[model samples]
Every structure is written in structure tokens, then in C-alpha cells.
Target: MTEHTGSYYAATVNKATDYPPLIGDQSADVCVIGAGFTGISTALHLAERGYDVQVVEANRVGWGASGRNGGQLIGGISGEQKVANHHKRDVEDLFGELRWAGHAIVRERIQTYAIDCDLKYGYLDVAIKKRHLREFEADCRRLEKSGFPHEFRMLSKSETSETIGTDAYLGALLNMGNGHLHPLNLCVGEARAAESLGASIYEQSPVLDIEKGHRAKVVTERGSVTADFVVIAGNAYHALERQLRGIMFPVKSFIIATEPLPENVVAQINPRDLAVCDPNFLLQYFRLSADKRLLFGARFNYFGEDPAVIRKSHRKKMARIYPQLADARIDYAWGGTIGVPINRVPQLGRISPNVFYCQGYSGHGVNVTHLAGQIMADVVAGTAERFDLFASVKPLVMPGAHLLWKPMVALGILYYQVKDRL
Candidate 1:
């Protein structure tokens, strides 16, 4: 099997762990499939609640999106406002409470587990158009009315340029509450935390199938895990169930890490070291690493895993934003697939009463996945209020999504690209 610790975050992981593959029949109170953030988060939550949990991963821990994400901890779920609009009630109270809950969970977990992932606070939601500025102003107003604890300010054009060293944006909404981190380390550290709490994790053990009933049995190549409930948290990399396969499209996002910049260059650009995301359907998000490298990311028409091509495409975009970085050497380039539902909301529901699944967070996986893990855990524990809020929104499944995912995703990207330009 390929080594999982080759990614940039992997190279700098706080700790290295090698767990054996599942080799025999095992049983637990819950069996989770896939060891990405969703699976690991769910397993960790259940284990913390004193449940016997066994996690089965196709690769090593954090090998999928969890290990490969941009690590921006922006709050709020995808399409939450639209979902709340459908309830015909005051969802402000419900969503307002849950909006920053994931952020709280992340901060508490980092402190409680002592996960060394270079966690920091500060982010900017930048605007490129007058409409974007208006929306950001509205967002700032809402946060102010809600008495947001963190420092949030609306930046003028000059302030925006000063903060980001880029005149590409018209203005920005800065929030000290949001931040970035080393995602893979957090995932691995959380898995370790779960392991310490008596949870069992098996790597290189892809789940072949799940036999569902009162007690679900997850069958791997070399072992089987029987549990009272089964949680499928694979997100976009999952292939175990046919029902979820065709329900969403896997869109590829790529990122490139430039060599650590000079102190003056770093000071000139991103002096505050805050994560920044543009407001566009096909967006670009970037931030500086603890080692002082500019990690830039974007979506493109490509889907292959060629690092050279990713570097070429993403470097050009990065240079467009900051021309001084045009000659910077790219140290790392990689891509990962994100499961995007048709309606842009996260998919959380049950294939069976004893089997629950949550996936398709669009690009907001980091924050939403943690909240989802909590919701999934609550669902298994017979708390369905928050679970139902998401599960009620059924996924819009395409006719041939599984068979034609590539073409479909390419078309969707093209559509979004056009929309972003307009």
C-alpha cells in the first residue's frame, strides 16, 4: 500500500502512528467506515461518550480529504440559511447556536488533547464585487446584532489591500474567530486521542461491504466488525454503498505550497497571517503556513492527480493575486475530491434505521464535519432533533451520477465558472 504520510502535513505530523490492519472478527457499540475527518470525528465523539467504537479505513488515518484539506476553520454550514428558510420558523435561534459550535469544539479539542497543529485565529472573507460587499456588510450586521464574541470588522478598500497585500478585492470582512491549522495533524491527533479513550482504529482495511440489521456487520478484506450501529463518514472518497455513490458529484480542488518566503515578503503580504477566502462560486482561498510558506488553492477543469499540473495551474493563479510570488518555487502540490450535493447542503441521513451516513459538505468540510460528527453521534444515541434538521433535506440524485461523475462534475464546474465570472 502507498504511504499516507507523504503529504506536506504528513511530513510535519506531531506524531507518527502505525496501526495494524483488521485481522479478525471484532465487535463494538459502533462501527465507523473511512478514517477521514468525518469518520475520525464521529469515532472520537463516540469513544469519548464511553462507547466501544471501531474505525475501518481504506488507507491510513487522515488519508483522504481530512489529510489533504486547506485547513481553514470558517464557521457555518453550507446552504444553512436556505435549509432554515424551509422550516417556516425562527431558525435563527437554532442555527445561531450551532453556527460557532464547531469552532468551539475545535478549540476545546486542541487544548484538551494538546494537539500541536499550529492552530491560530484570524480570517478574512474578501469581496470582489459591490454585491459581495453588500452581503458582507449584512453578515457583519448580523454578527454585531448577535453579540459575536470575536473581533469582527468591515474593512475598506485601503484596509483590505493593507491586510492582504492584494488589490484584487474591493473590501473584506475580517473575523478574529476563524483561523487555519495543519488539518492532517489535527485528524491524526484526534484519532490518537480516540485510541487513548479505548477506541480501535485499523488502517489499510477498506470496508468491502456492510451487512445491516439490528446489529450491523462491516466486512473488510481480512476482518469483520459487528456493531449495534454503522456510520459511513467517507464523504467523497467512499465507494462501499451504491445508494450514496450516485447522489453527489466529486469535485476536485487543488493547492500549492510555495517555499518559505523572505521576512520582508511575508511582512508585506499577510502580515497578520490570516486565512483569506474569496467570494466566488469558483473560489480561491489562501493562507500562510507556520513555516512561512504561502499555501494557495483553487478549483479548475482538471481532475487528475498530477502534482506538476496542479502546481502549474495553481501557481499561475497565485501569481495573479501576488505577482511577487511568480518565481517562488512550489514545494508541494496535491489535489483532493470534495463531495458536493446538488442543493449545496450537507447530506446527512439514514440508509437504514441502524445505518447512518453524512457527507457532501461542499467546501465547508472542516467546520461542518465536526458538527456533523456530533449530530451523527447524537442520532445514534437517540437524539434526532439536530439530525432531523439535516436529514430532512433529501439529496438530489442525478440519473447517472455514479457512471458519469467526471463529465457531470466538469459540467458543474463549467457552470460555476461562468457564474463566478458574472
Candidate 2:
């Protein structure tokens, strides 16, 4: 259960960060747990605002999904349209303003902190069926109607193949606003920025218990932190709290990074270097790393920490998309868990007035988590407009969600497989 780092992103992390574990009583305006994107982002936001903030992590910084995820910077929130349907307000007007807020934040953070995370521009939402093409068309129309600042266009079958070197997609919607980056470096760089702004961070300091009150006391094995407010940013990796444990199901997603290919192979595979994602319910997302290696990701049935099994499953899926890569050597294989709420909307609310929580971004964590951090900071400061928007939607908690996650996820995979086929 204990490993330093196995993914290619971890192997090449620009800087390694180490902080002393919590060992004595401490106090702060805010204390965040988990140390992933959500925790780091929130601490950064708070610290920048002149608030005293501290972050405690059970593992090293960016050790969870934040470091291991496919670096696709996709737009929009998952299941947002459904939530919009439930409201009387113009969903477009309300969410459109916030849709790209995370991207803007990410871009600014990279520039401000001088974080080199192999950031790139351009992405394609590819379609596997005529229905998916229709969806893409609708999305393009929406972007135009919303007066999107980015260049967005729909590609025909030939154009799609020319752009991605794959014939599996019927069509695609190209959005320059969406892009990719090295996620581990981004998270760590953001943590550095937060620290520079006076946020204290402790790694390998897992919270053992929380004593809730007007000011909560977060207890670790050897130390504790009392704070005006506590934010649980642990998401799927967290197991400390009973309320969080079984509310959201942990779904494992795997990825394989192939060894850098020949220049011609790279040219033939992804000429424009756009990140590509398929429209299947059980999705496949791929993009080129800065060093010109293909990073392919897919959802599979196997669970546990066996990298060999993960590599085999993901490699087969990669070959299916581009048979020319049947012999591509996989350089790294790893898996991470994503918190999937029953409604597919990210859960944001207060367990107590002084104890706030945010989790369950499904597979949309990269973009949405930043937005969530901002919303969380806003909530801590008494601005609840955006927070209420999400909190108003109740999470669908399944019985024994933590214990039955494996079987439930298998069922979901089968269901999405059928849906994708239809």
C-alpha cells in the first residue's frame, strides 16, 4: 500500500516537496486535509487572501488522483445539464460564466508560479456514433451562442482522422479552450505557491479524528490542529469520516504511457497534438506527453494495486483504438480512484457550519476541482451563492457504498458498455 511514485509524471516531477509531519498542537484560520488538487487549491486561495491556512496530507503531495490522472483539461461540469434542468434560472447564463473559470485559474497559476507542467493547447471531443456527433454539434452550437472566446469547430470524419490519426470516430468537436498538462507538477507547483503566500503544509500527517465544534480540532497520530474551519479535501482517497466513507463510490480508472515513438509515428498518430476523448459512457481519453509519448487511459474491471494487470488491460484498449500501436511498449501503468456520486454531480456542503466538505467530481476532477476550491473558499468567507447551487442538489448515497464499490462499479461498467454500444 506504500509506494513513492510509479507514473511517468511522478518520475519526472520537476521538484520533490517534503514537509515535517504534524507533531504538536497548532491552530489556523483554515485547515485542509487530503493534499490533492482540492486541498492545495483551497489552501492557495485562502493563503492568497491573507488567511492563515494549513494543509495536512496522509501521503506525499499530489500522491492521489491529482498526480496520476490523464492530464486533460476538459470544460464543463459533469451532470450539470441535469442539475440545470431542475432549476428555473437560465442554466446557460448561470453556469456559462463559471464554466471556464477553472481554466482561467489554472492558466494564471502556471504563469504566476512559473510552473512548467508541459501545458499545451487544443483538445478534441470525438464521437463514436451518430448520436455522439449530434451531441457534438449541439455543443458547438452552444459554444457559439455563448460567445465563447476560444476557437471551436466541428470536424468531419476525414478531418477527425487527419487530426487524430484514428478512424474509430465518426466526427469530432474541436475546442482550443480545452487542453492538457502534467497534473502532478501543477498540483505541486500550486502547493509551492500557497506556501510562498504563507500557507503551512504538512505531508504524511493523516488525520485520525476530528472534534467538531465552533472551532474544530483535527487530531493526527502525533499532532493536532485547531481551526476556525476545517475542509475535508480527501475526496475518494479519504477514509477517516463515517459520513464520507459510504456516500460516494470509488471507481478505479487506469492509464498506460507508451514509450516515446518515432517522429513519423508521432506525426501520423497525433499530428496536431490535440488531447482526444471518446464519447463512450465507458470512456477512452488519450493525449501526447511533452516528450512525444502517447498517454492512453481507459476504465477497466480489475481492482487492486497490481500494475501488471493494469498495463495489460489498458494496452489492449490502446491497440483497439489504433492498431498500428499494437507493438507500442508501455512505459508506465497506474490506476487511481475517482469519487462518483450517484447523481454524478460533485458534492459540496457543510457537515457542520465550521466543517465544510467537497468531493465526488466523477471523472471531471481536473477542471471541476479548481472551481470547487474557489467555491469552497467562498463558502468559508460567507459567500454561499455558488456553494448553495451545488449543496442544493442532494447526493444520492447508496447503502454500503464503500464496501460494495467494486461490485457497483462493475455493474456501472457493464451498463455503460451497453449504453456505448447502443
Candidate 3:
């Protein structure tokens, strides 16, 4: 079985899940691949809709990027502006509802399943540039126009410093709707909930290749699943399908968790207990876990899996923001891959009529994945409005991109780092 990385989330989960690996042929109404947020969320939605669903994972549930993300529950899809601009006709009236759809799903799931994932409902978008502040103002306006029910306010430079105990940001936009959580725990809880709804989840069941037919067959090493519909929901770690590759470039993001902070220290920084994110391509995101430890994450050019290197690299970056944490004891570090599309639009379409795929959320997987789960279920159940909206945006397929993902990501990081400086 593929073990989960030594992430802080894994270490402090509500409970460990030991799902059985797929060893025999199984039949279901729908077969989903990759037990991360997308697959598990899709399964949960399908099972809740009274569809028999089975999820197959190459590793432990949420073992990939879904388990190791920043856990910030930021709202809106990545590149929403670009999507709305390019497909204005298609998204004109419904963008507002679709923008925060996943947040609603997440809120409902957490409460319905009674999942204790340390879910909070506050976030800050700290701005480093004047342009970023402009974007924040526009975001605030959109929230107002939509009659959003969350408490949102902009913090001036001094207020930003006081709120986060940092002078790195010129200002910040606080949104009570977006927040952070224990993502692994959420994934596991959702998986358990799906199982409770009669959804079978098999761990360590790496898909070899899929056989497309009237009833699609998902082949694994030791077993297979034949279902009326097959959903490939793996985001960044998926490699079973040739067409899913290259269209999305994989980038590495790393995170480090500090030892529990003192109450006074916590009060000084993030007193509102809000998830914080900066405005840069190589951005820094942070939040205080329920236990009070500061979890900091960023995207770096480095791609290797060395916890010490990750911790050291991020300790320096974190100290730059919160210098008081210069000597903060690092308790855990880990990294995962994010699938980014060339146009930054999430690609949701089909490998075949019966075989569906949903991926390329960029960095908005936490919220968007649940939204995607809903859309995937809708598509399978003969509703395609939302799916068609995304599918209409042509995915840019870069040939041989996956084969050269690492170097390409390194170059992209270098380019974005320079742009961020400018």
C-alpha cells in the first residue's frame, strides 16, 4: 500500500482509515479513480444521489496533493476572471453562484457528516502590490453585488500589520466565507460518509489502463471495476490516461508546520484565526491550525522530497513575514503536485461519452473539487449545463509537457518569480 506522506495533517487526523485494497472484480453504477478530493467528493455526491459508486486509489485516500495542500478554503475557481472574460456569454448570469458553489457544498458536508476538520470561516488576501489591492477591491465589489452574507473588510497597511503581526503586506481583504481546515481529515470523513452511503473505496489500487466500451472497464493490477460510467478524477498524480496528460503542467508546492504557538503569540498574529494568502504566483499561504500551530506553505522551484530542505527553505521565508518565528520549531514538512492548465482554466470533459474526467483546478482544488464533484454527478445523471460550460473552454494541450514537467515547472517558477518581483 502506498503510505501517506508524513504531513502534519496525517499525523493529527481525527482517525486513521484502513480501506481494503481492490482485489476482485467489482461492478458499480459508477467507478471513480483516485481517492482524493475529486474522486471521493464525486463518489459521495453520486452515492448520495442513490448511484452505486466505487473509488479506486493508487495510494491511501487523500495521499496525493489533496492530502498535502495548504488547506486554505479559498473561494472561486482559479482564473475565474479569465474564464468569465473568454466565455462571457456562457457564464454571464451564473458565475456568481458558481463561484462560491463549492464553499456551500463544503459547509454542508462538514455539518452534515459532522466532520471535525477544524473548519473555520475567515480568510485574508494580503496584498504585496498596488495591482493586488486593486484586485481585492474588485473582489469586494463582486461580493457586495452578489449580496454575499459574509463579513468582509479591507485592512489598511497599519491594520494589516496589526492583524497579521506582519508588515509584509500593504493591505489585505478579509473574507469570512473562505477559511481553512484539516483537509486530510475532511477527505477521510467524506470517504467514510460515502462508504456509509454504500460507496466502495479501495486503496492502493493503481489503475493500469481503462477499456472504453458500453460499460467502461477500469483495469488495475490485481483487479478491475466495470461500471456503466467511469470517472477519472485524479488531479495532478494521474497517469493512467494519455489524453489527460500534457494539457496540464504539474507544479510542486511545499508546506511546513511549526510547533504549537503560545496563546499570546497567536493573539499577536492571526488574532481572528483567519487563513492568510499573499498575491503572487509563487505565493505564501498560512493559517493557524486548531491546535494553534502555524502551517505555512509556498510554491518553490525545488521539486525534491526532502523535509529538512523544505523546512529550512520555508523557515527563512516565514521569518521574512513573521520574524518572531525565526526560531520557530518546525514539526513537519511535505510537498505535493498541482496540475495547472496553460490558460489556467480547469479542463472538464470526456475521454469518451461514457468516460468522464475533471481536473486542472490550479490551486483552488479544495473548494472547486467539491463543485466539480457536483458537476461530475450532474453530467453522469444526464445534466450537462455546468460541465458544458467548462468543456466549452478548450484545454491547451502541450505535447510532451508531462514528460518535461519538472524542468518546465522550474522554468515557469523562475519566470513567475521574476514577474512577482516586478
Candidate 4:
């Protein structure tokens, strides 16, 4: 009865949020567009700071990639190494704090709000090639140097198989800090938490236009929000703002959920309940759900949402890693878009002095968006140290990215697939 994609997450959420559609003019200290993770998270942060906040969503809350992702809470921002290189001398001063800020925010929100999103700890980055192993080794040293609180270890080829019950990976880097959760539920819970903090959210209200001035006016067909500051938090599904179109490539990722497996099968695979990801440009990630279904994800260039097609393409990829599930029944198949900047840096900057936009987290939305939310709130509250660090870096754009995204993404995928073999 709504616009949300028919996915397993939608079917199983305990209860749906019922925020009203915007019908009359409203006002707040801050108005946020796109009520996904970023918008809700920012609103929560601002409300916690005693700022009056209002959030406007084009559809239901988290009705985009924020809700449809693989639910992997992988640590570190996308392109941390490259972004840190922009400020090499301060790498230790900032990168260490930036790397885990999102993870800390997530853990704090879960406990503080009592969100029931099946939150768990543990993750494995599986190595597909020796180079991947080297990268993992390098990352392990970084954590060791920083005195990471959680456990992290580099696993041997045989140890990788023993840990995951699959021989598909040559090795793995296990990090207890990275983990998984029911993302849709987490988003809804955060929205509710924001509301309890005095933030107002309007659902099913597509932002028609924004009038920029000393005070920004976020307009909808039926209502408008006048606020001192406005934030664009739509990420990849954002098409309302023309200035943001070329800043990132809107790539698609698909996923499928197998029928709940027996306990014996679950024990054989992913017994530690760790989210698993591979080291490839076109990579696959998977983990067991709260109910024991294997939610497998594959990154690719395709953009359509035909369930049969996604099921077919993803089933083949999933089989390559876990042949035991070759014949497993697929209960759900869906796709979501990711905003990927060419430089792979998360974009955070101002469209105008009083209006800010944050997007292009690549596939690192779950973790980075939380960090971006905090940074955006900080900027709104007259603190710009963290926000300026990201905003100052120029976002790399693919030429004609808006007009020729599909062909460009196809070529990009081919280039990576070829390079992965080398």
C-alpha cells in the first residue's frame, strides 16, 4: 500500500512509523530533507543539542538505501586512506578519531535508545588475492598501533575456512568492532528517538523546492518548512537538488534473502554471527539475520529491480562462495542505489552558507552517514573543525556523470573486473 520496495525487512519490521504528511507551513531552527539515516541522524543530533529540528521525507522514513542495505556495520569511512592522505601530517590526530566515530555513535544510539535491531558485534574482511592479504596485514598494524579496544586478528587460509565454513577466501581479517544489525529498524528507532527529543518529522512529503536566503525555506507541494538552516541528507536517492547530481555516481547494489536455514546449517556457516565481506571492486557480502536467513549481497552495475533477475544473478554469486546453499530457496530479492564519488570520499559541504549537503559515501552508508550526521550537526551548532575537514576536499566527479551514468558505471565495472584479475 506504500512505495517501499517489497523486501524481507519491510515484511518483518515490528511496527511501521506513522508520521503525518506535511500539510501546513512549519518552522524550526533546522530543517532536514530526506528522512533516511542521515536526515534522522542529523535531526537527532541537533535536537539533542537543544535545536528545534524538523525532518521532511519524500516517502516513508529510511525508504531508500538506508533501509535496503546489507545491514553490515563495517567500520571506517569509504576511502579513509585517500581522504587521510589529504591531511597526511594529521593522520594520527584525525583519522584515528574519524575512523571509528560512526561505530561509536551507532553503539551509543543502540544502548541509549534501546533500539531492538538485532545489533551484534564481529566482522570478517575476506581476502580474494594475496594483495588483499597484504592490505589486511597493513590495516591490522594500524589498529595495533592505535591500541584498538576490540580484538582483531589476521586469519590463515585454513583458519578462514574453519571460521566461515567456506574455502572461497584465501584468508581474512577479523575485527570485532565491525558488525551487523537490522538497519531499517535501526533507522525507525532513531527517528522515534529524535521525535522524543522534540524533533518533528513529516513523512510522504516530497520536497518540491528550496528557497535560499538568510533563512532557508524547504518547500513541499502542500507545506513548507522555514528554518535558519537546511541540510540535504538524501544521499543516492536524492534527485531534487540539481547541484548535487554530478558530485557522485548513483550505482546500484542487489541482495537476496534465503529461507531461514536450519540450526545445523547455520552452525556450519557463520557460527560466530559475523558479517562477512570480500575484497573486490565487484564484491559480495553476507550475514545471517535475526531469524537465521542468509542475507547475501552483491555489488554490480545493474540498476533494475526485477526479483527474478536479481535472484538469478545473486544466486550464482552466492553459490560460488557457499555451494551448500546452491539450492536454497530465495524468499526476497531487491536492489538499492549507492552514491559513489569518483575519489571515494564522503562529500560534506555547503550549498550555501546556511544550507549544507552530505552524500557520496560510496557503499559505506551505514557507518559514514552516522558520522556525517554528527558532523553536520556540529557545523549547524557553530563547530566546523570536523565538517571543514571534509568540506575542504574537492569532490572528484566523472565527466557527464549525470547524463551517462549507466554506461559509465558499466565501463567502470568492466575496468575493475579486469583489474581484479591482475
How well is each residue in 1-422 modelled by candidate 2, as lDDT tens digits? 24445898988899888888899999999999978999999999899888899999988889999999999999988878767875666778778878888899999999999999999999999998899999999888889999999899999999998988888889899999999999999999999999999999998888999999989999999999999999999999989888877778788888888999899999998988999998776789999999998999988777785779988888788898889898989998888888888888889988888898999988888888998999999989889999989888888778887888889889988888888899
Cα lDDT tens digits, model 4, 1-422, are 15778787887776788899998899899999998889999999999999999999989988899889999998778867676788775566677867888989999999999999999999999999999999999999989999999999999999999888999988999999999999899999999999999999999999989999999999998999999999999888888777787889888889999999999989899899999998787889999999999999997768799999999999999898889999999999999988888888899998888999999888888888999999999999999998978887888766677888888889999998898887
Supply the TM-score for candidate 1. Answer: 0.98
Per-model TM against the reference: 0.98, 0.98, 0.98, 0.98
Clashes, model 3: 0
* Pairs of residues clashing in candidate 1: none
Estimate, for each residue in 1-422, the C-alpha lDDT of model 3 and write its tens digit. Answer: 57999999999988888888899898989999989999999999999999999999988988988899999998878767677777765443657788888999999999999998989889999999999999999889878888989899888999998888988999999999899999999999999999999999999888998999999999998999999999998888888789998999888999999999999999999898999999898999999989999999999989788999999899999999999999999999999999999999998999998999999999999999999999999999999988988888888888889788878888899999999998
- What are the per-model C-alpha RMSD values against the true structure? 1.1, 1.2, 1.2, 1.3
Better of 2 and 3 by lDDT: 3
The lDDT of each candidate is 0.89, 0.89, 0.91, 0.90
The weakest ten consecutive residues by lDDT in model 4 span 88-97
CA displacement after TM-score superposition, residue 411 of candidate 2 (Å): 1.3
**Candidate 2 — worst ten consecutive residues by lDDT sum?**
1-10
